[model samples]
Target: MKDLLTTTSSIIVILFCCCVLFLGDDADQHLSEPDSEMITARNHKKFLKARHPLAKTTLFRRVQSVRLKDGVLMFVTADQNGLKEHFFIIRDKNVILVKKDAGDMPPDSIKFDADGHGGIQVTIPNTFELDPLQDLLSCRN
Candidate 1:
């Protein structure tokens, strides 16, 4: 009976030690991750401050173009003061608009037709000819 009791106590202690060791390792791994993330954020802030003094300055930047499939659906190269920098589209059926900070300054040869609401649409030839160089199928901007 004494031998049995000794064996049981040894097994219990072994299991308790294993659990403590594994839990300690997991805790250490998790503890290092947050510290690295905090260090990275701190370093990026220091780099930005040293490189660009006016990085935090605020300035007005207005939307000027809404394009769909290489087609200039809307064009506003320049906006007048007090005239809205952004216009809301009430309806854009079958249209995916892209916002461009550079505005609609396409080559002069690509003519635009009035689509109303300060927007222009690219006119395609009625013959249905495709430009071999132009591939506007991708959904990504």
Candidate 2:
């Protein structure tokens, strides 16, 4: 009878240790950020800092062109303002939206044109507007 109790206690102790090790409370802290939010935040940061400051003036000139590749659907507008041009190349959807800043100029217009070869060109005017991309993304196929 003592042998049986000892064996049962050992098994219970082992099980408890396994559970504590494998299902520890520390697991939650290590989780990575969601993909969507990460993408949005990264893109937002790029817009504020202007990854290529010269590219803004040179690449965003009037009638300038911006191309987007597959899996890359969002972009900042050429305008110095904080507007972002989000595109859904899968469905040929495009929209203009503005980002917030303490001291930023407003953008005026956003234009979207598609190339026959799965490419898109976006143009932004001098003023900012609401996130038109949201409405475009919500539409059903």
TM-score to true structure, per model: 0.30, 0.26
What is the lDDT of every predicted structure here? 0.44, 0.47
Best by lDDT: 2
**For model 1, the run of ten residues with the poorest summed lDDT:** 51-60
What is the Å distance of residue 20 in model 1 from its true position?
A: 0.6
Q: Give one digit per residue, the lDDT tens place, for model 2 in 9-80.
A: 999999999999887756755554443354366488765654342332113323232333443334455556
Could you tally the backbone clashes for each prediction? 0, 8
TM-score of 2: 0.26
What's the residue-level lDDT of 37 in candidate 2? 53
The sequence of per-residue lDDT tens digits that candidate 1 reaches over residues 1-141 is 999999999999999999999999999999998766643664887654453332232122333433333332332334465434323232433332322232334321223334333443343222223341343454234
All candidates: CA RMSD in angstroms? 17.3, 15.5
Best by TM-score: 1
